[model samples]
Structures are given as C-alpha cells and as structure tokens.
Target: MSFRLNPFKVMRAVGIVAIVVYGVVLVTGYKKSKVTTTESVTKDMKIRNKDFYKSKDYKNNLTLPNQVVENNNEAVAKELEQTKPAETVDLQKDSDTSKQQTDSKVADKNKKKEEQVKLEMQKQAQQKLAEQKQQEKSKIAAKQAELKKQQQLEAARKEQAAAQARAEAARQQAREEENKKAREEAAKRARENAKKHQGSKKYIQVASVTTEASARGIAKKLGGNFYYKKTTVNGKTAYVVMSNMTDNPNTLKAMENQAKRAGSGYMIRSVGK
Candidate 1:
C-alpha cells in the first residue's frame, strides 16, 4: 500500500502554527489607541476639535505626560501590592506545612531516643545484677576456703596431741620394766649373802652354817653343811650335819656321863646301829 498523509491532520498542524505566530505578534508589538491617549485628561476619551467647537466647550487638552505616567505607575504599584500579599499567603501556608513535617520528624526522633535510653538502662541494670551475683559467689567461695583451712588445722592439732600421748605411754612402760628388774636383782643378791658361810654337805638339816671349833660347841647350835656338793639334792651345792645315835643305851650312858662330868657339849648322831 502507498503511504498517504491525511488532509485533516495537515490542516490541524497548520492551524496550531498560525495561532502560535499570532500570539507572538500580539505580545511583541502592542500600543495604546487614540482613545486611551486622550483619556489621560478626562475620565473617558474626549471628542476631537469638531465635536469640541460644536459643543462650545473649551477642551482640557493641556494634559501632562508625567500625570499619565504617574497614574499608570500607581495602578501598577497597586496591582503589584495586591498580588504580593496573595503570594505571601500561599508561601506562608507552604512554610507551615514544611514546619509541621519537620516538627513531626523531631518528635519521632525524640521518641526513638527515649526508647533507646530505656533499653540502655535495662541493660545496665542487668549488668549490675550480674556483677552482684558474681561478688556473692566470690564471697561464698572465700568463706568456704576459710572453713576448710580451719578444719584442716584442727585435724592436725588433734593428730599431734594423740601422737604425744602415745609417746608418753611408751616411756612410762619402759620405766616400769626398769623398776621390776631392779627389785628382782636386789632379792637375788640378799639370798646369796645369807648362804655364803655354808659348808659343803649332803642332807643338811638347814641351809645356814653351824657353830665353829668342836662337837661340844655344835650341840648348842643349829646344824648345817658348808660348801655342800650334790647333783640331785641341789643344783651345785650340798649340806652335811651331826645328829643323835640311838639303841646303844650302855655306851650312850657312859658317853653322857663323861660329857656331864666334863661339862662339854656333845652331839648325838645316827650311826650304823
């Protein structure tokens, strides 16, 4: 198919261009009309010289350019003054909206700061509690250690006391044994001294020694043996003595008579008779 441009679209574009050119021409070159130039002296535009002479009026045509310019300036100043207040009102409304937004942001920030401070305080309180607990635990541990040390010291003291008592008891036992030995030795020595004078004999009447010198002297004394010897009767000593002989009445009488006449002590002994 062949390309075709629509007539209505070309016409519409040409009309929009004509309207734009017309607006440019009107804005760039615009001047006041004759009516506006003459209206500067009167409130409305005056008629020309023909109408003035026909009406028999002396025209107020000596109008000043300064007055016209001044009036126009006053109108422009008033319009500008009126428009400025409206713009300022709109600006004040916009500034109020912006200030409200800024205040809202500040309030939100302060609220967040308060919340953060509360959280920080909570954390600090938790830390303080933890520290207190730790200190308590340390105190408890120290007290337990002190108690254990005291217990150990007490046990050591008791052990030392018991050991000393045991040593004292052993020393006392040793002293008792020494006293017993001494007593036994003294008794043995006394027995030996009492028997020292005895003679050797078998079957003595007693263990003590008899009188010295003769049989006449022997009848007046107790009889015994000195240095006696026998294996069975005693372990290493024996005893011998004199006694009466019996059953020879005539011979015994003669001997008794002889002893009585002499006043000599005679001992009676056993013989083979």
Candidate 2:
C-alpha cells in the first residue's frame, strides 16, 4: 500500500466534535446542579438515614427493670452455699426418736388443755361468789333502811308528846293569871267602901311649946284640911292643920311617938276639936 496523506481535514473534524461534546456536558451538569442543590451542603444539613440514627442511639434495651445487687456478706454466703457439701437425709435410722417426740408433743397439748379447763372453772367459782356477796349486801342495806325508818317514827312520836305537854303547861299558866286578876279586883272594891264610911269623930293632938315655929311646925306636920280661926292670946297668928286623930290619950301618945319618928323632927300637940 502506497501512502497518500490528507491530515488537515481529519484534524478539523476532531476539533469540532470535541467542542460540541464539551458544550453538552456543561449544560447537563448545570441543570443537574440547579435541581439537586446539595453539592455545597455539609453533614449538619444532610438528611440522615433512620437506620443510621438507630445504630447511634445510646439507650439500653437488655437491662432488667428491678435488678437487685448482693452485698459483701450475701455474696460470701451465696458462694459458701454453692461450694459447701450437701447433706443426705437418713430414711430409716431415727424412727424411735420421732415416735418419742410425737408422743411428748401430744402430752404437752393435753396438759395445756387441762390447765385451761381448770382456770375456766376457777373463774366461774369466783363469779358465783361475787354474785352471792352482792345479794348479801342488798339484804344488809334493806335491814339498815328498815331500822332507820323505825327510829325516825319513834323520834316523831316523842316530839309530839313533848309538844302536847308544853301546850298543857301554857293553858294552866293562863288559868292561874285569870284567878290572880279576879282576886286583885275584889280587894280594890273592899278598900273603896271602907274609905267612904262617915260617923261623928273626936280628935286629940299634942305639941311642944319651946319655940312657936316648932309648935306651928308640929301643927303643920299633919297634911289634911286645916281650919283657921282668929283668937288673940298676944295678937299673933296661929296656924293649925287637921288630920285623922284618935279619941283616946293613949292613941294620941302613940301618934306623938310616930310624929317624933318623922324626919320633920317636930312632936305632936293637943288641939281639941
């Protein structure tokens, strides 16, 4: 094959194709960028998947609601129990001892039942005794009340008797006062009758003459109606008084003695009327 070279036309065709492709690519990219708006966004603006959020959440899903923690002593005890030897129970060796224990338990229950019965009986006896005591007290109170009523009735009777005696004494005293008043009225009437007696009377009196004033004093010592008459023995006035005078000289002497005893100290004289 002989070479006949034509390079210009091939090169021009390649440049034109390249320019068209570049324009198409630029347009497509600009439209894509305008619709998406995510090329300049960061992780804070990015919408994350719900699956990724679930993986990153810190909440516990497997923990118990009321879990308990064993302390030091409890933990030790649990460890010892888990490591300790287990005891095996005997099936046939302790039969006689079990029977004896059962018998003793039955005996204790029976004894307690008997003691309860005895205590109940004692309580009943005490209650019966208390009831008897209350009855006896009621009887005694009844007797005391009856005795008091009797004593009150006796005292009332005695008071009635004493009041009657006092009334009788008052009646007797009023009767005695009535008799004494009647006797006094009778004696006053007799004395009035004696004072009104009138009959012809004689009088004799005696007097001393040492001083005229003394003889006139004796005459004036009598205190009844005085009669006056004038007679001149030596032209002097003589005054006299008349009273009840006795008719005998012996009675006149007695009257003179009585006048001498008087505190006026003038003796009686003879002035006949």
**TM-scores of the candidates in the order shown:** 0.39, 0.33
Q: Which candidate is the best by lDDT?
A: 2
Q: For residues 1-273, could you state the per-residue lDDT of candidate 1 as single tens digits?
A: 223344456556655655565454433322222333344434332246655644422333234366876786688677666652211124344445555655565557556655766676677777778988999999999999999999999999999999989888888888888888887888878767745744332221222222233332433443222122222344433333333443445544554444344343433332342
Off by over 4 Å in 2: 1-124, 192-253, 260-273
Task: Pull out the clashing pairs in model 2.
Answer: 205-269, 205-270, 206-268, 206-269, 206-270, 207-268, 207-269
Error of 1 at 107 (Å): 2.6
Q: Model 1, poorest ten-residue lDDT window?
A: 201-210
The Cα RMSD of model 2 versus the native structure comes to 43.1
lDDT of 1 at 252: 46
lDDT per residue (tens digit) for residues 46-86 in model 2: 35566753652212322323232235447657766666343
lDDT of residue 53 for candidate 2: 34
